[model samples]
Target: MNSKYQDFVPLKAIPFVEFLINEHNFTLKIVHQRETKHGDFRSLPNGKFQITVNNNLNKHQFLLTLIHEIAHHVTHQKFGKAKPHGKEWKTVFQHLMLPFLNPEMYPMEILPYLANYLKNPKASTDSDVKLSLALKGNIAAAGKNFIFAIPQGSLFIFKDIIYQRGAKRRTRYECLNLANKKAYLFHQNVEVASYQREYS
Candidate 1:
């Protein structure tokens, strides 16, 4: 286990990290929080492979994202230029995630959801609402309110932008950005600080 990533990944997850580094010769990097993606894998021209995971992720999410990126690395090695989340990657991801499905590795509350998710994993954990919500439930709630908790037509601040919640569209909410009045879809569970409207 590398001393540098001690603070990034939980102690229990160190063995899996070591396995990836030793078996695949992968270089691990903990990057700043990225709003769009959780992790990424890149195979350099010099035959060096690198995996980067978001620093903001909790223990479970961090480990999951690490394995997800490693699956990509392994898939790329086995079949170059293959579909990103094709059958090969799913097989690798499931195999790698099998050992961590127990209560010892994950909280009992989230273990069941995670186990079911592994049966047919999606491109991103966020795509699985149940699993994603379970994972988020383990983490401490932020000071900001959750988007789904707010009323429709409520105004809120998200990523420094103001938006008014419109209508529910399946798993996401339609929000109109106040700055440019452009509509965008946001996950129903996204956290945002509510902006109190002033009465004239």
Candidate 2:
């Protein structure tokens, strides 16, 4: 992992990069963008890939985009870009998302979303979880509001939620409010101050 990623996602970036190098034999390149974009592609294999991560995004978002793009790279290496989020891409997503689902290894910055998704990805989806949790007062705070119970990892969401998901869970969650809106969680907790507070 480079210093840039270290400055952003100090913990997961290295492990994620190692996963790419060892498991996929790929290198990571970070690029800052003018627009609020959280990682995109440039080239691949013979060409260099530019992960245009959203500088505005928090450490958790940055890490997620980085991992997501890396997963894309692996998918591209294994199967050239054909269909968006194709079978191979989905498979890679599954693999990457699986570990985060594990209790011992999950990062705190990504827990609420992961927990909701893992518990009932279809029912308790990220958005749904954020909504439910936010409604319950588990809101995300700026700066170091995130904390990892695991001393080594650098994220807050990993500590709070269990990663194990049960069968007969929803594969997707529906959030009417989330749709047609621009909202994202801060440290797995919803940012509600700016938006209307859904006081229960």
Candidate 3:
């Protein structure tokens, strides 16, 4: 463990590294050096990665940076390469980010900025609140009386919903994929769908 990150719980650190090694096949390296004018995590060509948490960084920021670097490692393994803050990196970064984030790490004051940069940080598995069809068309939904004027080929992000087993009166949602001109329907009060190529 780096002296700079002595406060981080070992249980949190070890499992995350193991997750990278086991799932993403990455080798983590901790190095000592003068602070560069750049980021704390870097990946080498040989699937080796370096994570540097400066002595001055606070606990939350350090953890965030560590996860961010790990995300880079995951992106490299998944896509062979990543564009700076592109879709692949953002997806992985957010995946790693949520596990450790708290009110301090993600305050309401910073939400708008983070949300814009994250570009849909709350994946389908993360939230129960789903945006409505009319909202995408610059209209709004009112108490189950929402209107839809969306055309075909529309893209949507369904939020995570909780469904009780054997419940007959299930929550249902239907919309169109404007881009593909296909109809999409989901039951909120049902088992979460398995990972299908459709979402990707």
Candidate 4:
């Protein structure tokens, strides 16, 4: 195991971590939670390549995020700053994920969904509700209610704003914020607290 990544990746993920480091020559770092992204890769102005993954992810999520970022690094090396999630990146991402698409690397529940997801990869795992939900099942429940748990037309609070859940549009739920009366798309697996209805 590389001493540098020993602290960031779990024991079960060491092999994959080593593969990325040795094969791609990337410097990996696991940092605190990043709100907008699970992981990212960049080439330093000094020419050093680095990848950073959020430390809060579970082992399975960590591995997936790491491989996703590694795919970006690989794509950048081959194509030189093409679209971030373009065809080249998707192809490389699926290729890197092929070896780990099994019960050993991921839970059986998530494996199938993950395999399907790789066929036409998206920008993020969160964008795939089935796969994201299956992955979330592997970790301890956060005790927060999921957006999918709320009935359609039911009001809920997300990020401190009140919204009414609407019809499902593929993997996301369409919602209307009460404050702004504007429609928004939310991930199906987003954790939200339910609001109690008040009777007049």
Candidate 5:
């Protein structure tokens, strides 16, 4: 776990996070990416606790996800069966994240957004577009562009589904899924595959 931590977390954050994992006796599993989530925590029937984080996340997101799951574990030990991202979890998550909000643990570019986010962190950091984009280093597949960067009426593919971009409704963009012809809201930072073609 010590060596694995080096690969997944920022250099300055390794020691503190290692302390939390060892103190809790958790089994941290770096698994393949799951589109719907960055990480999760669960208790085994055999009395073991495991936290799984996607292996593909960048170091900043990886550290955030690790602490996020650790907060879940700590919350469970204290609150027992509470709402997954309810007040209890939020409080625990905020407290656990406070220490890592520093320049040493995070980059200057990401720190401000992170500090503001931890004030009332959501179930996913992707909820904050500025923060999410910063975590991504504003980089995507060379030719791909963020959903927001494309014009309305343009076509884009996400998760293999083709969506036609629509108007901005408050924080998210409204998009029509070409397959089902149903509307779905997309985060501005969502990177959609770009290509040129004619579609009816």
Candidate 6:
């Protein structure tokens, strides 16, 4: 295990994470938070793959995002240019996540939801409302709010932008951007602040 990343993931996940980093020979970057994404993987112009995970995530979310990005790498290696969140990537993500899904890596409160989510993982963990909220519990901050937790017609702030939460559209919540009046669909688990506060 690399001591350098000890603070970023559960102790039990360190060695496996390190092994993936070493074996894949790709760059893993812990970057500042990006409101639109938790992590991403891309092949660089220099002919190397780089995976970046948001620095703000708690250990559990961080590990999940890391493995999620790694699954992309593995999927690409196996089936070049496969659909981003297609069956190939799903299988790879599930297999990679299995070793880290134990209680040692995640709290008991999140296990059931996490297991349920892995049964058919989505492109973003946020797509799994229960699992996303369960993981957010590990964050140090208190009184965290989510889009789905707020009442419809309520004003909330997300990514420093104000929006009025609207009706549910299938899985995501429809929201009207206060500034542009443009409608956008937000994942149910997207963390948001009350109209008066700034969360991100």
Best by TM-score: 5
Cα deviation in Å at residue 133, candidate 4? 0.5
Estimate candidate 3's RMSD in Å: 16.1
Assess candidate 3 and give its lDDT: 0.45
Deviation from native of the Cα of residue 198 in model 1, angstroms: 13
lDDT of candidate 6 at residue 182, scale 0 to 100: 100
Residue 86, candidate 3: alpha-carbon lDDT: 75
Tens-digit lDDT track of model 5 for 1-200? 35668989988888888899999898999999998999999999999999999999989999999999999999999999999989999999998887898899899999999988888889999899999998988887466899989999988888877888999999999999989999999989888886463222
lDDT of 1: 0.85
Work out the TM-score per prediction. 0.88, 0.49, 0.41, 0.85, 0.93, 0.86
lDDT of 4 by residue, 60-167 (tens): 788889999999999999999789999999999999988788777787878889899999999999888788888878333454578877899988887678899999
lDDT of 3 by residue, 88-112 (tens): 9788887776654444445444434
RMSD of each: 2.8, 11.9, 16.1, 3.3, 2.3, 3.0
Worst 10 residues of 6 by lDDT: 138-147
Number of the candidate with higher TM-score, 1 or 6: 1
lDDT of each: 0.85, 0.46, 0.45, 0.83, 0.90, 0.88
Q: What is the lDDT of residue 102 in candidate 6?
A: 89
Residue-level lDDT for 32 in candidate 3: 46
Which scores greater on TM-score, model 2 or model 3?
2
Score residue 167 of candidate 5 by CA lDDT: 99
TM-score of 5: 0.93
Model 5 misplacement above 4 A = 141-143, 195-200
Which candidate achieves the best lDDT against the true structure?
5
Distance from true position, residue 155, model 2, in Å?
35
